[model samples]
Target: MGREFIDLFDKWATSYDAAVTGHDPQYRDVFENYDTILSEVVSNSEGNVLEFGVGTGNLSKKLLDADHHVIGIEPSKAMREAASAKYPDLTVLDGDFLSFPKLDIPIFTIVSTYAFHHLTDDEKGKAIKAFNEILPVNGKVVFADTVFESEETKQEIIDQAKDNGYNDLVYDLTTEYYPMKNTLQSLFKQNGFYVTFKQMNKFAWLIVAEKQ
Candidate 1:
C-alpha cells in the first residue's frame, strides 16, 4: 500500500468498525465467520500470533480475549492508533505486509481478515514468501477475505447486482481488486504450504495454509 492509501485509511480509521459491520449483512457475516475461524485456529495452537492489517482491533480483541498474544501490523498510523487505544495491552506496529520488518520472534500463526485483497497478485506472492520465512515448519497462515472464485462467478455477481437494481454495484466491484481463490491457493502451495480453502459464502473465502 502507498502513502496515499494509508492516508485514506487514516481518515476512515475512527468510523471503520461500524461502517464495515453495521449496515451490510454480507459484511456482518464476514465478521461472524472470521471470528469462528480465528477462534478455532487459536484454540488449537499454543504459540503467538501476528495479525496483518489489524484494523480497529476487531479480530485482535477476540484473540486477546481468548488469552492469545497477538502482534498487529497495520500501515495506517490512524488505524494503528485506533487499535492501540482499543486494546492498550496489544502490540500494534506501523507497517504494511510487504514492507514490514521481519520479526525476531517465532510466529505460530499469521492471520489476516478482510485485508489481503488490497494487494495485487505479485504482492500477495511476496507476502506468502515473507510469511514462510518468519513461520515455523508447522506454523499456519489463515486468510479470510471477500473474493470471487472465477471470472464467471464475478460476472454472475455483476449480473445479479444489476438485476437487483444496485446502481453502484458494477462501479464498486470494478474499482477494487480481489484475488481469485485458485490463484491464492496456487501461490500458497508453490511456496511450500499445504492449503485448504473454505467458501464462507458466494463471495467470501477463508484459506488456511500450514507450512509443509
Candidate 2:
C-alpha cells in the first residue's frame, strides 16, 4: 500500500484494459454484472458520483454516456492519462482510496470495482466509514469485486483460474487480501450502511450499501 502499489499499476496501465477485459470468458460475466448494477444505481440515484480506482475509465465512460456526473480518483498516472485521453471531459485525479483528497460535491453514490481489495480488512472498514462521513443520508456505495464464501472457496477459485489459463490472475488472487462476502457485508453494516448483496458468479459479487 505504497509506491510499489502505484508502480505496479503504472507499469501495467498500457495493457491493463486488455489484460482485464480479455482475460477470459468467465470474466465477461464480472463486467456485465458491474455495468448492470452500476446502471441500476446511477439511474436511481439523485446526485453525482465519485469512482475510486477508475483505472482506464471503462465504468466512468458508461456513467458519462448515461449523463451522470462523475469524478474519478486513480493513483496510477499512466492509467489516469489513458482515461483522460479517452474522455477529455472527465475529471481524473491522482490518489488512492485510502488517501484521496476530499471532494466538495453532493455525492449520492460511490462506486468501485476490483480496487478495494488492496486494503486490508481493517482498512476496508476505515474506507467504508470514510464513505459514510462523505455521503449524506441515503447515499450508496456500489462495490463490485472478487469475493468468496470461505478460504476453501478462494483456493478453489485460484485452482480453477490456473486451470483456465489465467495463471497471473490466480497468482494475484492468492497473494492479495480478497475478503469474504459475508465479512464484507458485516463491515458495511457495522459502518452505518444497510447492505444488499448479489452474487454475479462464483468468484464475483456486488454489494449495494445505503447510508443510514
Candidate 3:
C-alpha cells in the first residue's frame, strides 16, 4: 500500500511542488525550516551527508549550500528526475529507504524529512537499524514528520482529512504510527541512538539522534 503511494508520488513528481503548494500547509513548514533543523544537527564542517527522500531537491539545495557533500536516495524516478534537472551536480540515486545502497565512505550525518512516516513498523525498525549500521560513531540522524499527541488528536487529524476530501488516505491501519514523544525516543534508543525531539507544531516533530 505504501509502495503504491510512492509510485503515485513518482508519477506526480513533475507537478509535486505545485500540487502541494498551499494545498497542504503542514508540509510547507517541513521545507521552510529544513535548514534550521539541519544546522541543529550538523556542524559547519560536517562532511558526507545522506538524505533520504530528496523529493524535488527541496532540502538537497539547502544541504549543498551548507558546504556538506550530499548523496540523496529517492525511490521515485520522476522525483529523482526533477531533482537531477534542478541540481545537475547532485548525487541522486533511485532507491528505497529500506534498501538504499550503502556507501563505503564514512557518513557524518543522515537526514530525512517527512519520509519516515511512509515506512511500516517493521520497515521503520529495519531502516533505523540500517542507519545505525552505516553511520559512524557520533554521527547524527535527523528526522522530521507528523506526530499525534493523543488518540483524540489523532482522530481529529483523520476527521480533518475527511473534511478536506482525503477520505481515501487510509493506507495505514492505525494513525498511531505517527509516534508521540516517548515512542519516538524509545524507537531511537532501541536502534542504538540517543534521541532528542522538538515539537515543530501540534502535529509535527523534529527528532535528532546521535549514534551511540
Candidate 4:
C-alpha cells in the first residue's frame, strides 16, 4: 500500500544509512538518538517480530543480535537488497504493512520504526485490525516513529522546520501521514489494544500496544 513511495526509498537506499546516523543535518531531529531508538524498539519487542517497512534492516539487525526471530517486510527493492547485503541470512521479503506474505507461525510482537507514518490513519487502523487477527491476546506492537502530541504541535514543528529553511523536511512533514498521540490511543483502544507511548526523542515515540 505504501508502494507509491518505493522510488523515493529505492533512491534513498544507498544514503538512508548515513541519514539515520545524523550525517544529514535537515533530518537530525527526526532521527535523533538513532541507535538508542532502535535499541529501545528491540528491547520492547517480544518473540517473533513482524517488522513492517524494515528500511535497511536497522531494527532487524538489532533484533537478530538480541536473538529474536525477525521477519521483515519492505516495499522497496533497493532497500530489501541493501538489508539483504548487510545480513545475508535475514529473511526480508517484498511487502507492505497491509499486505505482506502470510506467516505460518504466530507473531508475539510487531515492531517498526520511522516507517508507520507512511500510512494514513485509516490505513493504520486497517493494518492494526489485521495485526489483531494474527496475534494472540497479550501480544504486542512496539513501534518507534515520529508521533506528535497534537495537531498544533505537528504544525508548530512544521513551521519551525520552514523557518530553519529545511524545505525538504517541511515537504516530508507535510506529505507523510504522521498521527497524533491521542488519536492513536483512541484508535488502538477501539481495536482492542492498550497502548502506551514513551517519548524517545524530539520526534520519535516508542509505542507499545498490547493486544487485549
Each model's lDDT comes to 0.76, 0.78, 0.71, 0.90
Q: For each predicted model, how many residue pairs clash, with residues at least 3 apart or on different chains?
A: 0, 0, 0, 0
Q: For candidate 3, list the clashing residue pairs, or say none.
A: none
Question: RMSD to the native, candidate 1?
Answer: 2.6
What are the RMSDs of all candidates, in order? 2.6, 2.4, 3.3, 0.9
Top candidate on TM-score is: 4
Off by over 4 Å in 1: 1-4, 24-46, 162-172
Name the TM-score of candidate 4. Answer: 0.97
| Better candidate number, 1 or 3, judged by TM-score | 1
lDDT of 2 by residue, 1-212 (tens): 23347776787688767645546464554454555655554554456988998888887888888788898999988989999998899999888777887787778889887788878888899889899998989998987777888989888777887788876576678677898878898999899999987776555677789999
Residue 172 in model 2: lDDT: 73
TM-scores vs. true structure, each candidate: 0.86, 0.88, 0.83, 0.97
For candidate 4, lDDT tens digit of each residue in 1-212?
A: 46677887898899999999889888999899889989988888888888998889888999999999988999999999999999998999889988888897779999998888888999999988988988899999999899999899999999999999999899889998899898788889989999999998889999999999
Question: What C-alpha lDDT, on a 0 to 100 scale, does residue 45 get in candidate 3?
Answer: 27
The ten-residue window of minimal lDDT in model 1 covers: 22-31
- Candidate 3 local lDDT, 1-212, one digit each (tens): 14546766676587657633534443343345444654554442257888888888867887888788898998888888899999998999877777777686788888876667777666777888888988888888887777666667777767665666554344331442565566667778999999877776555577788999
Candidate order (TM-score): 4, 2, 1, 3
Shift in Å, residue 99, candidate 1? 1.1
